[model samples]
Target: MVKEPAVTLHLTRIGPSWMDPITNFLENGKLPDDEKEDKALRREAAKYAIIQGQLFKKGLSHPLLKCLHPDQTDYVLREVHEGCCGHHIGGRALVITRFSISEVVVSDNGTQFTNKKFTEFLTGLGIKQKFSSVEHPQTNGQVEAANKVVLLGLKKRLAKKKGAWADELASVL
Candidate 1:
């Protein structure tokens, strides 16, 4: 008779999730030793709930939004970005992959676009940043026309299913 080796399998958490502290506090009344940390945890835990053993954060639009672990966030983002219903034009990947160095970049006067690091990058690349002016009819008209086209496309793609508009946005673009 031949002897076979036995394999042992053990389940383990890849890493401690952001929700661990809140979940532990809500479930088991456990709190951190630090005074400030424990108080902060208590305050934050009030915004979350344990429903059917799953953690959910309170939201504005909806009552609850299911919270996912850090490890699972990437998978969820990928699915929403490239899955069957998704068109893959949105998310951080869009900024990373689709952008090209341009001579003149037109953008709104948002803090993000005007930040020091972004300004330094543009200056280093010799790119001129043009902030779209509300007073300029020509620039505003062009932007409005572009927006109209996109809105029309989205409207045609989704007649009554307004919720799927995000997934259909890249296809329209």
Candidate 2:
């Protein structure tokens, strides 16, 4: 009997520090005696959140240019596909990701994945792309769970150096 390839989902996200201040303010209302400083922090955090939300709405999420260049993305996808599929050319593998434009380009109006080059790249590598359902995270529950595990591990490993997530990613992984 032929065994099926093991399916895997790669998950990535912006660091927690980017959203912590906003979440703290949301839950606690405001900070004591430092209203002006707290307000500024909250505003900056909210701005970042809004920008991220807009990007998500436009089918663009993690693995941004700063995180991974398009060429690097192609390389990583190829490596992961081959490694997970026993290095078989034309082996079938499915990749599930948020509607990140870095992974999949949506049309100008956000109606569809309109990037022919990306589609062709996947086709060439015998890989299939699936986007998590809008507002339904259960579709990618395993990956989500894995993300939490990684974050927890990183939190413990990094301690107070939160901004060093990228630097410590290799050890975390």
Q: Give one digit per residue, the lDDT tens place, for model 2 in 1-173.
A: 74752443355654444344554555555553587877687665443323322221112554322223233456567766666555654423323332333343221212223355545544655656665555655545754565567558756666655554344343433
Window of ten residues with lowest summed lDDT in model 2: 105-114
Q: If scored against the real structure, what TM-score would every candidate get?
A: 0.42, 0.20
Point to the candidate with the largest lDDT: 1
* Model 1 global lDDT (CA atoms, 0 to 1): 0.73
**How well does candidate 1 score on lDDT at residue 153?**
70
Writing each residue's lDDT as its tens digit, candidate 1 over 82-170 gives 66537745568767766686798676555655677667666777999878896876886676665567558756656645554344433
lDDT value for model 2 = 0.46
